[model samples]
Target: MYDAVEALEGRQFDVVYTGKGALCYLPDFAQWADVVHQLLKPGGSLYIVEFHPLLNAMGSVALPGDTDDLIIRNDYLEGRGAIAHDTTVTYTGDQIPGRQRSFEWMHSLGEVVTTLAATGFQITRLRESEVLQWPRFNGMHQTPKGWWRLPDEAPRIPLLYALLATKSD
Candidate 1:
């Protein structure tokens, strides 16, 4: 529920961050762009560090059910509607007990970049690093340089990522 384009008529803010909260749940990119543009002040910066949407498209074999505690996926690729489940996520930090699950959309890395560029925000610095703060992937371990890429025996896939950019003056 946002009239982003209309709000741009006369208003501004120092920063417009759209990563951690419900914004990331946006089902439409064009609309999300509006919110980012209107909420940003002149020369202000926009930093979005979100979970890799591509990772969201994965089809897992995690156990299934509410009390059973397992996988929770909603066919976002089809977009019929969210087929939510009850399962708790076990992250490195905040490994809260219990089980609860929900549906999520998939946005490729390119999609994320293109969406921002289309919004008038210049790509300042794009860095792809392993999970730094709290890794959700079981295959992510820290290293001297930073979060190590190698999770198990061989390092092949990346855990999570971040994006940093600023609005052009």
Candidate 2:
């Protein structure tokens, strides 16, 4: 990873895009922001389309005997440190034969925007959507566009969010 960073040194990119379920693995926003800032050219942009922090905090695990209900099962903010999980099942209906452990950190929207701002990026756009790429919950339905969404009667929530930030010349 350090070698990749070094190879890109002094390089400028017109745009950088990061997708869903990526940010949770990053432990330090400041370090990430520094790398992004270094990669962008003057007036270049960074676009992040990711799962909303609220959705991450709520998690995709169905409540016991209540797969229809969404619950806050994790931290919504950063101060609590990393969360560790041990599982033998994968999200794609595959079962792992051996134990697996993973660690993740929750980052609020405020933290994202602030980190970019501190790194000298100007926030251009921010959008939140109720659409998801898969059925995160038991009763979600897929739309014509292939995205999943909560049923009409379910309370609306932001499942995904996108932000655009530009490095000024």
Candidate 3:
């Protein structure tokens, strides 16, 4: 993103959209916000629809465990830098021929909002949803829209979130 900002050479856009777990791959929210700000024209908007951080706190779903209840197995507020991941299979239970190593950083919703606000973005919309595109846990149920969510008796938590912020004019 920083490279794109530089490569654009003063070019600005009417909107910038990012989502679907993209923020986790980024190490610095402040730097990202700076790049977004530079890329957008005055009054342009940045829209993000991503997996909620609460899902991160649940740890890896691939691990062997009973899904009878939700558990907090990881940190919600990330102060610990990058988390390393090594996996040989995809989330859909497909096996990979070789292990893949990756690093990700957790950014709380507060951090995301603060970074954008500090970067001169006026937050316009923030929405959290309990539905997910896939059934992340065994206890999840398919919604009418074909999305997945916890059963009615289960606690309602945010699985996804969408935020919209506009650059200050």
Candidate 4:
């Protein structure tokens, strides 16, 4: 963990991409922002494409019988700190022998933007999409382009979000 920042000591990058389910595992955005800032040169940019908090709060589940039901099973915003999960099964259908424990924290859009702004990064763009990379919910359909989206009859909800931030030159 400590070597992450050290790995890019004097090097600078034009762009950094972070995404999917990555943010939840990070307990400290300030430290993350600092590392990003250090690794980037002036005028560099950071692009993030991640799962929306609303989708995360809903808690993706396999609803084979009832595909239309949308439920909020978890907190939408950060309240009691990190949420802990202990399970043997992985998302990829793999079962481990030993105990598997993980911690995740939900971050609101406001918090995400403010953290980057506070770290001196300028927000360039923000986009929320109804399409997802995978069928997060049952009855999702795959488009010809390979993206998954809800049918026209289903309510439009943001399943993913992307944000671009740039450092001052």
lDDT of 4 by residue, 1-169 (tens): 3357687566889998997988888887778887887778899999999999898887544467655567888888876789888999876659999879989999888889998999989999999999987887767899999999988887898999999999975
TM-score of 3: 0.91
- Residue 50 alpha-carbon offset, candidate 2, angstroms: 0.4
lDDT digits (tens) for residues 35-80 of candidate 3: 9999999999999999999988874345566445778867777689
Name the weakest run of 10 consecutive residues (lDDT summed) in model 1.
Answer: 67-76
Candidate 1 wrong stretches, greater than 4 Å: 1-10, 21-24, 58-101, 139-152
- In terms of lDDT, the poorest run of 10 residues in model 2 is 1-10
Which has the better lDDT: candidate 3, or candidate 4? 3
lDDT of each residue in 27-137, candidate 1, tens digit only: 675577657766778687777776554345433356554232113343324334443445565332355577756544455567777877887878887766545444444
Kindly give the number of clashing pairs for every candidate: 5, 0, 0, 0
Candidate with the greatest TM-score versus the true structure: 3
Off by over 4 Å in 4: 1-3, 60-68
The TM-scores of all predictions, comma-separated, are: 0.61, 0.90, 0.91, 0.87
lDDT of 2: 0.85
lDDT of 2 at 23: 87
Q: Which of the two candidates, 2 or 4, achieves a greater TM-score against the reference? A: 2
What are the per-residue Cα lDDT tens digits for candidate 2 across 1-169? 2233578766778998888888888888678878877888889899999889998877555547655577888888887888998889865658999988888888899999998998899999999999998888878999999999999998999999999999975
